[model samples]
Target chain A: MILLSLLGISILVALIMAFIGDWRFAPEVNIGGSLLTFIVSLVLALQVYHEGGSISGSTYFFVDYLNISLVVLTTLVSTTTAVFSRRYMRVEREHGRVGHWRMRFYHAMFQLFIFAMLIALVTNNFGVLWISMELATLATVLLVSLYRTPTAIEAAWKYFILCGVGIAQALFGTVLLYFAAERVLGAGGNALLWTNLSRVCAQLDPTVMRLAFVFLMVGYGTKAGLVPLHNWLPDAHSEGPTPVSAVLSGLLLNIALYALIRCKALVDGSLGSGFAGNIMMGFGLFSLLTAAFSMLRQKDIKRLFAYSSIEHMGIATFAFGLGGPIATFGGVLHMIVHSLAKSATFFSVGHAAQMHGTQEMAHIRGLIRGNPAVGWGMFLGVMALAGMPPFGIFTSEFLILTATMKDAPYLAPLLLLGLTVAFAALFRKVQPMVAGLIPSGQKQLSAANIPVFLHLALVLILGIYLPGFLANWFHLAVEILK
Target chain B: MAHTLAAQINSLLAALILLSAFALLAQRKIMGLVHIFAWQGFFLALSTAVIGFASGEHHLYISSLLTLGMKVFLLPYILYSLVHKLKIHRDIEAVVNIPTTMLLGIVLVVFSYHLTAPIRELSNLMTRSTLAVALATVMLGLLMMVTRRHAVTQILGFLAMENGLFFAATSATYGMPMVVELGVALDLLIAAFIFGIFFFHINTTFDSLDVDQMAKLKETD
Candidate 1:
């Protein structure tokens, strides 16, 4: 009932906000809807906690330990994004970069995007999952091109075509999975249900499952912004509204990885082969190395953070690919922390960009000198993201690296190497921006620093001391995934 | 006798779809690609109807109708209007030459047949042989997208690829669920609209619909 209400309230708010055409009420509605959904999702998480976390309602919705954790993380980030967008988009409107009409569309689409992702998370049917993912893509494409600049259009088009093609391959893979499952579970709806298929997965055709995993990985991997398939990530991130970039990096990419993980669960259950993990690890390591190098040369600050997102996602993917209890725990923890840290970074970056009037790294100087709050927020967020001490990311990264060293000793050094390179590249670009002499004529800091500090504070707390209940839940989720 | 007759008819229709894929590859005019794409859809619809009748899977009849309505009529009309507005009735240039593309398409067909051999052996479905052809059509569409420089032609290739997928679904599994079929149809319509909107933007921005010009977005060395 809570899950249904959450979806209903989001869609309702989106629909109501569509016709109002009033900017003032838009954020109120947007934040209100997100807050309601978050509270409801929190309640759902508690219910799942007490009820042992694996519950399916009929054929459509499934909430397991993994799904509940993701649901909570998604609602939390979206609510914060809604809060941030309220201030950021208003400034955009004041500057005439966004008209009232566009604001309405943006607010509505933001709600709809969250709704679609929620659907994707809770759905048990793979087909519905695909449709929900497609809906999310369409919503984000509009958001990416919201500026209507030529470069923005180009970015949106590339994102659409590449992810579109990639997703079509995933559909083919899903069909193959259905075909394989049909032989064991027998036909109709049951064949495609994750629970049913996973129940009898061992009897499935291994050859078909292997082919399906390849297609699913490539398809969803494109959305996850994995390397080689990640050509569109930097452009999309650089061109869109900063809030959308935050969601793209923080929420949507993680959801895509969530879908991939779900598929991996089924595939692993079926074949009992390590083929899926090997492929994920190969893609993960390559993406990590590639993004680290890519970040070294980035001229745009947003694109720099975009590459960081790819790198962090790669690390998470690598950890998941390693697939032990400890690694899974670390991967899930990394996902949550990365989402918080990256979005917080973008929040500060967004304000800094607005104040400086450009996203170019060279033009912006002494963020802290210009505006201490935004500057300090960026500093702490980047520190957390770069795996500095006393942050959740450091803890998660440490766990993953130690897991890697324990299991595959040879691979640990490469992981360490990639992390080191990225660490150097990010600091090289960021340190001068934050610590230098303040640029003249910089605007005053906007009060939108709440989401940033709030996120960093959470990361700080998690880094220093993870709550017992949440840590327990993370362990349970990891067990379920393994 | 009826079984043999249905099998032959299915093979013949699948062959027509393959031929249309090749025609799309070889065609130079943007308008010609649209016609070829519609023809491929027509043949796909025919094959689905035939298989539906032969196998008595009644849901496939609905699928055939959906394919015909979306692919044959609605999409081509949308693309045609787009072409008319853009005023690009000129010949389409290939990034790769026509002869090479055709040769590659043939190689893909042979490869798909080899790849599907095991699945084909396992299935006793009436349209099993068409599975290889469906895969080939999909590959050919992908190849067309790669070789074409024009945005409209690339859209055509994507639509053709989708047609091949529909054919694949019909042949391999007697079609996806009805709900899924309807959802895919809706998605195709929305994609067409989105592409149409982008085409206008692309034309206005660059004063040309050639996608190669989009490379200006990357940093110049």
Candidate 2:
């Protein structure tokens, strides 16, 4: 019942947003709706935790240990991005970069996007999962093109085409999966349900499952922004509004990986082999190295962070690919901290870009001298992202590295090389921007820095202390994945 | 006897679908591409209905109707009007020459057939024979996207890929759940709508639909 209501509330809010999204208080509504979602997800999380097992509300939807935390993280980051966008978009409006109707479209689409992602998280049916993933892409495509500039249009087009085609492969994979499952489950809607398929996964045909996993990996891997398929990531992140970038990096990528991991669990059970894990590890390491080197040449701050997101996602994917209790625990923790830190980073970057009226790193100098809050926010957020200590990222990266050293010592040096190169690249770009001379006519804007600090504080707290409940939750999730 | 007839018809439609995919690859004229896409949709619908009749999977009948309504009629109408409204009904320039693209498409078809061979051997369904063709159509659609610079042609390629997926679903498993089929159909319609809106946006912003001209976003050295 609660799961139904959560989805119901999101859809209702999306419909309401479509109507009243042009109002002056629409941003407030977006934030309120997201907060309510977060609260309900917390309620759902408590219910799941208390039950200590998966809850299948219906054949259509369910809540498991695997998805409950992601649900909460998604809603939390969305609420913060909403709060940040309230001010950021208002400034854009004041500058005449956005019109009222587009604002309405933006608000409505944002809620709808959240709804699609929530569906992808909780849905039991693989087909519905694929559909919701595609829906999420469509909703965000409009948002990415909200400004409708030549570049924005191009970015949105590339995103649409690449993800569209990539996701189609996923659909083919789904069909193949259905083909494999139908023979065992006897041809009905039950064949498409994750719960049903996983229960009988071992009975499935290994050859067919292997083929299906290849397509599923390529399909979901594209959305997860794994290397080679990650061309759309930096472009979409850099071209869209900063808040969209935040969610794209922080939340959407997690949802995609969530789908991939879910599918991997099924394939592993079916094949009883490490084929899927090997593939994920290969892609993960390659993406980590590629994005790290690519970050060295980035001029746009958002693009730089976008590359960083790929790197972190690469790390998370790699950890999950390693597939032990320790690595899986680290992967889940990385998902949590990366969402918090990356979204927080984008929050600060959004403000800094708005203040300077440009996203160019060379032009956005003296942020600390001009606006200490945003400057320090950017500095700290990037530090957290670069895996500095006293941040949750450090803990997660440490867990990942130790696991790598123990499990696959040969890959440890390459991972370290990627991390070090990325750290150096980030500092080289962010140092002057935060501390150099203030540009002429640079004035302080009343920035919404609370969400920034709030997220950072959470990361800080999480780094210092993994509360008993969260650690327990991560352990349960790890066991479930294995 | 009835099953054999249905299988034969399904195979013929599958061959036609593959031929149309190849035609879509070689066609330069926008109008012709749209028409060929509709024909591909027509063949897919026929194959689906034949599978439904032979297997008595009543739900697949609905899927066949959906393919007919959306792909053969509704989507083609949208693309037709979009091309007319945009006044872009001219020859599309391929990033690679058409001959090379056709050769590449042939390679993709061969690869897909090789890839699906194991699954084909495992499948006992009457429609199993068409699985490779379905996969080939998907590959050809992807190849179309890669070789064409025109945004409209890319959309066509995407729709063709979807057609192949639907065909795969029907051939391999009769169909997905009714709800999922409906959801996918709705998604495709909405995708078409969004693609239409983007065409206008792309046209206005770039004054042409050639995607290569919009190269303003890259790393500045």
Candidate 3:
């Protein structure tokens, strides 16, 4: 019942938003839809907790401890971002940056994007997963170009072409996966179902499985913002509206990693050689180091956080690659905390950008003096992102570090270096902006600080004390992964 | 005898598909690139039909029809109207010289063959031999994207790559599940519509379709 509601509400909301999206109350409708979805997801979490295993709602949808938590996280962040977009986009209209048509388009596409993500998360079919991921991309490409500026168009174009080509490779990989499964499952739709494949994965051809995993890694890794294919990540995140950036950083990257990790489990089962895990670790560590260093050079505040997203995803990916109970636990925790903190930072950054009328960090001055609410919000959010103590990120990062030290002792120093560099880079840019002299005649916008503080408060609570149920949830998910 | 005949027709279609991928890489006129892409789609449909007949999988026939309609008729029409409306009839310049691009294409073909050797050795399917050609076509399409400068040509390269993947699906496993094939076809249609919208947006914003002009988004000092 919860599964059907989750899908029904998203589709119904998308349709309703498409028709009435230009109206003044459209933002409220968007918020209502997201809130309803969040509530439904919480119900899903409760059901999964009570059930204590995977639930096959049908042949089409599957829910387990792993995705139930992610579903709740996705809907929660989306709801908060919806609220933030209400205030932020209104200010944008006053500046004549977006008119009614674009606003309608934005609202409709936001719901569709969420729908695509929800489908991607719950679908039992790998083919459906691929299609929904592409749907998410198509829905967001126009959103990225919403301002219709030259640079916005360029960013959207680059995002479309790069992700288009990269995702095509993933289709090929999916084809390869089906090819390997066809023999074992006797050539039909049953071959593409994840549940069936996992049960019989050992009987699947290892050579074909290995090739398929490599293609799946590159294809999904591109979406996950891994290095070498990560050029589109910063441009898409920075150029889009701040709410889009929030979800792109906080939620979309996790979905891409989720797809990759799901496929890795099958490959690991078939090969029994840790081949998939090693490849993930290599890409993970490389992305971590590269993005950490890249963060220092960013002039745009959103881009700085965008690169930090890549760094954190790299850490999660690396943790999952370690392929043991401890590291996988750390990885899952990192995903949750990073999503909360990063989206909160984008919320603060969005309001800060509006106040100063720029995204360039150099021109903005004295955030605290200008508006204390937004300033302190930005400070705490960035601190959380930088993995400082007393924040949830610190706990997750600490767990990952210890896991790395115990398992891959040689790689610990490199991880420490990346984390340190990212820490310094964030503080150096963020401190002055928060504390320096207030620029004269800076008009304070009525900012939305609730979402920002709400997210941070949750992160703080998780940092100090993780409840037993959530811990049990993570442990169960890790078992499923192994 | 019927099985051998079907395999023969399949290989011939595969060879034609690969030739068009090469043609796409070497074609300079935007109109010519679109024509080559259409021909590539036709050959892919033909190959899918032949594979279906040989394997007795009725779903491949539907996939073939979908490909023919979307790739051969609808997508090309969209591309044609876009080219005509945009009035970009100028010859496209390759980033690398044509000869160098062709040499690279040849190298990629060889690499694909080597990559698929193990699979060919293990599989017993009639379409197994064409697997290398499918992979080669994919790589060639990627090469086309890299070498071409025009936005239209890059899109053509992308479409050609999708054709290659479809061919791979048909040749490797006869076809994916009917539902997946339909979903993929729908995605292709949506993607084409989006690409069309973007072309106008790109043209209006930058006043040109040269992807090179879109360099304002890099990092700063």
**Candidates' TM-scores?**
0.97, 0.99, 0.99
Docking class of 2: high
Error of 1 at A156 (Å): 0.8
The C-alpha stretches of model 3 lying farther than 4 A from their native spots are B90-96
lDDT at position B22, candidate 3: 90
Q: Candidate 1 chain A: worst 10 consecutive residues by lDDT?
A: A17-26
Clashes of each: 0, 0, 0
RMSD of 3: 1.1
TM-score of 1: 0.97
lDDT for predicted candidate 3 compared with the true structure: 0.91
Clashing pairs in 3: none
lDDT per residue for candidate 3 within B82-181, as digits (tens), equals 9889988655654558888999999999999998888888779999999999989988888888777688988999999999999988888888899898
Question: What C-alpha lDDT values do all the predictions have?
Answer: 0.87, 0.92, 0.91
Candidates 1 and 2 compared: the better one by lDDT is 2
After superposition, candidate 1 runs with Cα above 4 Å error: B94-96, B219-221
What TM-score does chain A of each model score against the native chain A?
0.99, 0.99, 0.99
- Candidate 3's residue-wise lDDT over A1-482, tens digit each? 78989988988998898889889899999999999999999988898988879999999899999988899999999999999999999999999999988888899899999999999999999999999999999999999999989889889988998898889889888998998898899888888998999899889889999999989998999999999889999999999999999999999999999999999999998999889999999999999999999989889999999999999999999999987888899899999999999999999999999988899998778999899999999999999989999999999889989989999999999999999999999999999999989987567899988899999999999899999988988999888888
Model 1 score (lDDT): 0.87
